[model samples]
Target: MTQQLDFSVGMGKETTYGSPSAVTRFFESEAKAKYDVKTIKGSGLRPTKGVARTSRQSISGFEGSTDIELDAPTRGLGFLLNAVMGAVTNTLVSTGLYQQVHTLSTTDPVASYAIQEALPPIGGGASNVHTFRGCVFDSLEISAKEGAYLSVKLSATILKMLTTGATAASYPSDDTLFSFVHGSIQVGGSLTEPGATTLAVGDAIPAVNISDFSLKVARNLDKKGWNLGGAGLRSRPPVLGKPEITGKITAEYTDNVLRDAYLAQTPLVLILTFTSGSNVLQIAMPAIKLKGEVPTSNGGDVITQSIDFEAFDNGTASQPIFIVYRTADTTP
Candidate 1:
């Protein structure tokens, strides 16, 4: 009998674009990754009949997406972060501790991965493994609600797919998942250097009641760089275009700080941190402008404000988003 628990997702970094990489790590995901092929149909008029010909249809390319329950695994989370941010710096902090700082890359040829999804074998049949090559994240969303663990959704552009040579799935033993109780948000800080600025403990916003938050970073890749002779696949990797960073925060409407900032068009810094034991994940947006709506009442319920914000470079040389992960893992 087939079982949903038997499905697995594995990934590894690719040294070369569109090249297959060995499955080095597995993820505890919410569902199986999906890969869909793009196709094109010839529009030629056939004098033979009124029905369209099936031979005119052809494959063009592939795209995929997956959702993972975000966890602080010793060595695998950085792979997803690098796919989104394009760059990472890993440093050993102390004994059995390391810090990984992920930043946006300004150059081409960002990191790519070979992702494998293993379907549960049919009754007494071998498992089917679908490997997606040259997988680059086009967008990544990290979200956290009131009573759930942090989740990550990745939309990827795939160059090719293979369905053979299944690799056994293996998970890390030191995985620690972060929940909403382990999260905190700080807002309304000033950035001295805008994109390059780091927030200190004193920069924390005081007495802010937040219910939920989400951040989405998109690397709007140009996926139309196909050539005539490339056999229905991308001739080269998708060209990275400008990055778009946006987010939303739902918080209790207790003060006029956020409303006043929205009215005055103030530039604010927002920091979100999640901690579980010695593992910590911090996302810092150095400069952002709020587009907030006033809180309204509904049947005597507590009023809440939903604020939409966008991150920008703030005229600095550095990238707008910075993610720092402190964990015991040594490598990404």
Candidate 2:
């Protein structure tokens, strides 16, 4: 019989980029671990050799990236989103027994540390566990479909990877999990329309004929220190490049509202809500500048319109994109 090798993973925010840590938070979902050993080739003529010879390649750098598919929830998903956006929550407002997710900012972001491992043996054994430090979110893709569970895919870049011989004995539990059954979309705000600046709760977009929707957030980060120093990987964090927000929507061609917005360069408001009983998660973009052309096709099933849009800031610090969730966590 083959030996069972059960794995466990944990993550935590790091104080400094490229610094290792024993992550404390555990995620109970599908996770894939990845690591790369960058090397520099030395294929040139030697001093004593007549013909060109090759020498032992030197270890140039170490980097890691991971993709995790998580169920959309209030706690872990909120935490991951805040980390990616480089935002920290400063307030939590609650009424009755529900705690409302306050304004999440993207002013200053920090890296989150993670560990990919397995449950250690009783006393002593070779443990195949790796700890990563200074991890930053590279991209996040969220998808939802009718009669399907809402899920989120998170991609991250890490600085250093340390493979320890043995790991801690136990692991944490992922207890609070939320699905996508209670998802809702509130649309009806005008883009570039006069007297329509903010969106209210009553402007709920009907989802009776909607098929699927997706939202992608990317932090176009530039990985530096690739050719720095002589030996070992560098200990500096990556520089954040231009942040981007893009998404696609698949819905029935109900009207020419979105098409009109795309043509007139209108700025629209979108509020995506996910709720599981009392727990709720909201992704609100106040000023989403429309881009690309609206494509339509007549199929045998139904008439659907698919268009792409990009989120942009309308010269405001705190009004571009807002990620609100219902949790006890005041800060992420």
Candidate 3:
């Protein structure tokens, strides 16, 4: 029966496609079998042009239809089995798991890898392909000046998708998975001196989104309707989508978004702001708990606070965001 494969996960529903275990089992069975076939002949007189015989008894002794003794190699059971095994081996490696999946990696807006670049058309981040797990529909990034209040604005529809499916709906409707962590001090790019800065207290914050960009997934050549038993493959139905975070970063943040981030350790930074000061209060990026809050300065009255964030990696150059542990500044 033709299997109706709908991908809730990794397999091509029904039974046409063999699983990884099937190929593994096939290999195991191939190695253990003992019965084999072979063919050879002994000949003295030639009955037919292609007959297994020689003019003299030196090469082939003599010949008779069944009477001519079969050679050790071609006429034996080993030869027959060997021929059959050859075909089986071809099927094994050709349509095996190793041929399908290769390397796997995670990607985001900061860093990304292509899956379709490996294999086109058949190899897309769609229902048929695997490796697309926990991916969301879209993502965006927004940046703004700092202010007195803590906020992250979302100009882009973070949760919204290209296709308006309910489960994949965008903002002004549901909650978001990605959130902010610790808010901190950012070096103002525009500031010529230390005091000339902006605060993020009253602005919006948008999250760094990582979407359906695959790091790496191999080509499943033998991935048939009931293809390799990958919990990732789907028959006719759709495969699970990769988790995605797409939206512009803004200075506006909802109460829930800010509060939950303050509670959980997931997103790392949730709120950040800057104010006029003589010394550096804190650094923005990694989360850190400190005693006492930094009071806002006004010169008793001008622009009170100002700051903005730029993700940086101390040692590793390419990484946009880095998680690092801090200790006493003994050496410096």
TM-score of each: 0.89, 0.80, 0.17
Best-fitting candidate, measured by TM-score? 1
Deviation (Å) of 262 in candidate 2: 2.1
How well is each residue in 232-254 modelled by candidate 3, as lDDT tens digits?
22232212223222212322222
Candidate 3, poorest ten consecutive residues by summed lDDT: 22-31
Once model 2 is optimally superposed onto the true structure by TM-score, how far is the C-alpha of residue 119 displaced, in angstroms? 7.8
Q: Which stretches of candidate 3 lie over 4 Å from their true place?
A: 1-300, 303-309, 316-319, 322-332
Instruction: At residue 299, give the lDDT of candidate 3.
Output: 62
Q: What is the per-residue lDDT of model 2 for residues 1-332, given as tens digits with 9 covering 90 to 100?
A: 11234456667767766655556556665446677888776666667876533455666677778887776655555667766766534343444223433332344344556555454455546445677766777788888877777778888876677776334444224235444557677555533211111222425454554567788888787766565462556556666677788887776777777778888988777777776655666667766766645756676666777767788787753456665666544444
Ranking by lDDT: 1, 2, 3
lDDT of 1 by residue, 50-141 (tens): 67678988777656655554544434677778778888788877688777888888898767788888787656455578888888778888
Off by over 4 Å in 1: 37-48, 54-75, 191-202
Model 2 earns a TM-score of 0.80
In candidate 2, the residue pairs with backbone N, CA or C atoms under 3 Å apart (3 or more residues apart, or in different chains) clash, namely: 86-109, 191-267
| lDDT accuracy of residue 324 in candidate 2 | 60
Better of 1 and 3 by TM-score: 1
Q: Which should have the higher lDDT, number 2 or number 3?
A: 2
